[model samples]
Target: MEPLALLWDGILAATDPAIFACTILGAVIGLLIGALPGLGPTAGVAIMLPVAAGFGGVAAIACLGGVYYGSMFGGAITSILLGIPGDAPSVMTVIDGYPMAQKGEAGRALGTSVFASFVGGFLGIAGLVALSVPVSRYALAFGPTEMTAMMCFALSLLSVLGGRNAFKGFTALALGLWLGMVGLDPISGLPRYTGGSMNLFDGLDFSIIAVGLFGLTAIFTSLEVNVDKPVAKYTFASLLPRVSDAVQTRWQLLQGSVVGFFVGVLPGVGASAATMISYALAKRLSPTPEKYGTGIVEGVAAPEAANNSASYGSMIPLFTLGIPGSATTAVMMGGLIMVGLQPGPLLFTENPEFVWSVFGSFAIGNLALVFLTLLLTPLLAAALFVPTAYLYPIVIAVIVYGVFAIDASTFNVTLTILAGGAGIILARLDYPAVPLILGLVLGPLLERNIRRTLIQSQGDLLVFVERPIALGLFIATVFVLLIPLFLKLTGRKKIAADEAEV
Candidate 1:
């Protein structure tokens, strides 16, 4: 069957009233969860996974995918109104969005966000529909050596692109790798890092770690900063921007969507990185660059669009390779596995309806998110008035519930608290949690592939470099690592020369 026909059939199936209703319910739940501080898409999905598991594959995926996109849209709500980012990707939105709120243009800022989100999200889904089959076929040819090289390349690129400090990113990555080494050895049956603890046999739960790192840590950080201050409120009659506003932002939205989609396709380069890079690039190329952080409509549009596009883009790798591109994608991946559907090349061909249903549902969910956001912004804004003391505790309760709900294990809850504490300390020391999460997600894959390659090659290490695809990936990894160092050296020399001249 042709891919186009398969996609059309999937869309028709997804648009069936039963599936559409499930998608709407999932989006509504996700939106509310994402609009609240400390509750990101990852946590939202984790909390809902068990419920999704009870349903069939199509319904399960529709609900999970809807939650994913809905959170992408709803995250901007708190970022704009409360200056508290609802998700890591929404952090950039707070820069321009909060400023607009402060200037009494909250409604317009939100309007721009919704429109940009729709554009980016719709484009991203289109890209996914157009690209997933090709990408999956390409991925199918990759053996253990090629897969290992690809993982190395992804980790290298992510470490370089992470933030100002490469060392910190590596530190986080290494910590995650070490944590991943726990439990039984992949090749040998011996346990290396379990330290004789029976509870460690299953390894640390990724969902627990995620809840602790993003959810609990965020709560602690909020409390430590200033939970006493009341959030300011602003009112506007409409949340819809003028047609001219959309026209003015067309270029920024386009560039951001494209950039976001590509980044999202890469494992470890998720929505946060895409949104931040897009916003920075948009500002750099804007005619009025100086007005960026001052609440310009384009400012909100660029990041919102980039983030939403990236959210959909990340799903490509997840569905194609079983490699999640971000924390939220990791949750989705886990949800799929829990529901007895393994994600990868076989998934696309064997479960074409499920794949297409997820893709089509993203398109529908984004539209629902737009309407829901328009209707709920006024109510969401009122949530800002809820005291942080009250809000924080509720958030904490939710995080606890979310953690336990995943596996219903007390050990998981304990692990979550420990991971949360570790996350808080890591954040204070400028270490990123994303790399750690990425490492945890990719660690098992990396180990399994390495052992498989060694076994296939009869312990010959040369097999990794012998293949063209693996060799190319290795070269790319080297370049990704070296370019940053070269750029830093050049920048330092220029700075030194300018200082000497002055």
Candidate 2:
């Protein structure tokens, strides 16, 4: 089927009552979750995993998709109203969003955010619709050798770009790789890390790890931080944004969306980075860069657009290459896998209906956010004031129930608790957990492909260099690895020059 026709069918299917209801339900839940100070999109998606999985099929993905983008929209509410970022990406939103609120233009600032988020998310979904097919088609040519190199390249990017400390990132990646190896050995048909237990045969479930690492870890951190709830100062004057504001920031919207989507498509880079880069670019291109932090609409618009668009952008790799660029997507990937769907190039050809239906749901969901944000911003803003003491217990209950519901196993619940403890330790030590999750997700794929390629070449390692695509990807991997060193050298040189001048 043609992409557009498939898309039309998807659009028709997404409007089904069950799918539509799930989208709205997920969006509402996500909005509340995102407005809460500590539970960001990653936790929001992670906590909802078992529920979404239970829904299954198009309904499942639709719910997850709604949560993903809805949280992006909701993140702005806390930042604008409370002067506290709801999530890492929303950190940029706080620079101007809160200031705008302080100046009594809270409605305008939120309107701009909504407008910008809508534009960014729309463009991102458009890109996803247009590019996913071609990317999948291109990726379809991947053999075992290319697949190995591709996975290696992805892991390398995660270690390098996933965190500030390469060593910590690599350490997390190694841990995840170890976790991925816990199941039976494909080659030897023997148990590896099971410790002589029957439960160890199938290894750890993805939902268990995701809920522990992101969902439970977030709750633990939130309780320790003990963030105070702040009351919103103003009722919204108007949910509708002023035309002049949108007109003035139109270029910023486009710039942010474009920059955000491309940055998001890269493995490891995330919405937070996309927003930062877009904000920097917007400021640099502005006539008055100094006005950025002073409650300017441009400031709010740029990052809002970038962050929402980046959320959509991250989906490309997840759907096409089976690589999730961020923690949220990693969990979503697990959801897809849990529902018996394998996300990869073959998905396009094999499951065109599912793919395009998801694309349609994204479009519908993005559109739904604008209405949801406008109507619910005031209510969601109030939710920010809900005490953490009340919220944490509910979140914990949900996590426990969700994990247990997966297979009705107390053992899985035990694993979740253990993983959560490990998550707390990793968090306290400042290790980036994203690489760990990605490693767990990609490790088996990498190992299987590596073995398959070696077997094909009769154990010759040189085949990696022999294939053009594999060699290119390897070279890219090397280049990515050297980026931190290059930055360090440049920083030292700049410091030396400053010292010399001093």
Candidate 3:
């Protein structure tokens, strides 16, 4: 069956009042979390991850997905109402959104954000519905060789494109790869680096690792430079915009939505990058490029649409390929595993019901997000009033509680703290943790697939290249590796040519 048909079937199953209510609750919770200055969607979902254990798989995931979209909507509130961005993705919104607010057009700015968010989200879902089917269907033919090559291609893209310093990204990835190799070997069922500790049998709990890397990292980072927001008076009247505003940004929304969806689908090109790139594209293409940072609705619409669409884009790989395109989805893989489910091509063939139900949740949550953001925009602005003194402590406490609550072990809590310290150190060194996390998630799969392929070929080293899909993916991996060198050489040549001309 087609992806849309499967999604439609899930929507039918998800229509139960219980699931719908969970979706609403999730959206509300997400909004509150997102409204807070630093607690973006990842933290919102991570802090609430323990509840996934109780809510059951479908309902809990429904809620998490709701929070994902709701937080995107909520992030704009602070960026427009206060000069401070709610999170990284909202940073671009502040450039144009705050200026609009300063000019007494706060409601319009907020309205544009909400409008673009809806459009972008719709386009992204449409992209998911359209693209995921073919990819999943095609992947059903994948053997161990193709799977290994694909994962290698994915890691290369993530390490090379996910951060500014590719070497640092690879270093973090190497750390994760080594860590992944600690447990009993997937092939031999024998321990390699257990250090004789039984706890090493399962290796690291990724959820604990995720919470530490993102949740604890956020909390620890907040301690150093928490800022207080000044009180501001604003009316909700302008949250409803005239039709003219929508009409003006219609093409911009379309452009941003397309850019956001495709940019978002690629692993490691996250929401922040999508928004910034979309904003730049809008500015460069605009006849009124000079008007971008001066508070134009187009500026607000472009990045808001792109980021929200990017959020939707991130979900696609997680559901279809068991590949997380961003950090939040990487964490979400743990949630899926907790439910005794794994994401991938088999999910579609074996667990069609679960797949469709999750799809339905995405639809319901996004629809609710638009309505909830519109109705509660004024109330949510109050989230900014939270003092850093109170908020930071509460967040720290919540991080500890969340880790322990889900893990139910003091050892996990200690590990979380240790992981947080590591994350902080990595951050200080300008190394990204996303690639590390991706490596951790993909490492085991890469190892398992390679072993399977090798065993099938009786240890033939030429097996990887013998397969066409694997060969193509390996070529792509080589290209990704060479990109930096190619760019460097191009830069040197450009400089030399310029010097000669001068």
Candidate number achieving the greatest lDDT relative to the actual structure = 2
Q: lDDT (0-100) at residue 50 of candidate 2? A: 90
Error of 1 at 391 (Å): 3.9
Q: Please report, in order, the local distance difference test score of every candidate based on alpha carbons.
A: 0.81, 0.89, 0.83
Q: What are the per-residue Cα lDDT tens digits for candidate 2 across 1-502? A: 4667777788899999998998898888888878877778999999999988899899999999888899999989889988878888899999999888888888888899999999999899888888898999999999999988888898899999999899899999999999999979989889989999888798778889999988888888876543464554665566588799999999999999999999999888899999999999999999999999999999999999999989988999899989888889999999899989999999998988888888888888889988999999888876655677787888799889989998899999999999889999998899999999989998888899999999999999899999999999999999998998899999999999999999
Q: Please provide TM-scores, in order, for all candidate models, with all chains considered together.
A: 0.89, 0.97, 0.95
lDDT of 1: 0.81
> Candidate 2 at residue 437, lDDT?
90
Candidate 3 lDDT, tens digit per residue, 347-376?
878887887797788887887787799898
lDDT of residue 202 for candidate 1? 74
Query: Candidate 1 vs. truth: CA RMSD?
Result: 3.0
Stretches of candidate 2 above 4 Å error? 224-230, 492-502
Clashes by residue pair, model 2: none
Per model, how many backbone clashes are there? 0, 0, 1
* Top of the candidates by TM-score: 2
Residue 424's lDDT within candidate 3 is: 89
TM-score, candidate 2, is 0.97
Give per-residue CA lDDT, model 1, range 318-395, as digits (tens).
899887777778777766876778788889888877888777777778888888878887776666457787877875
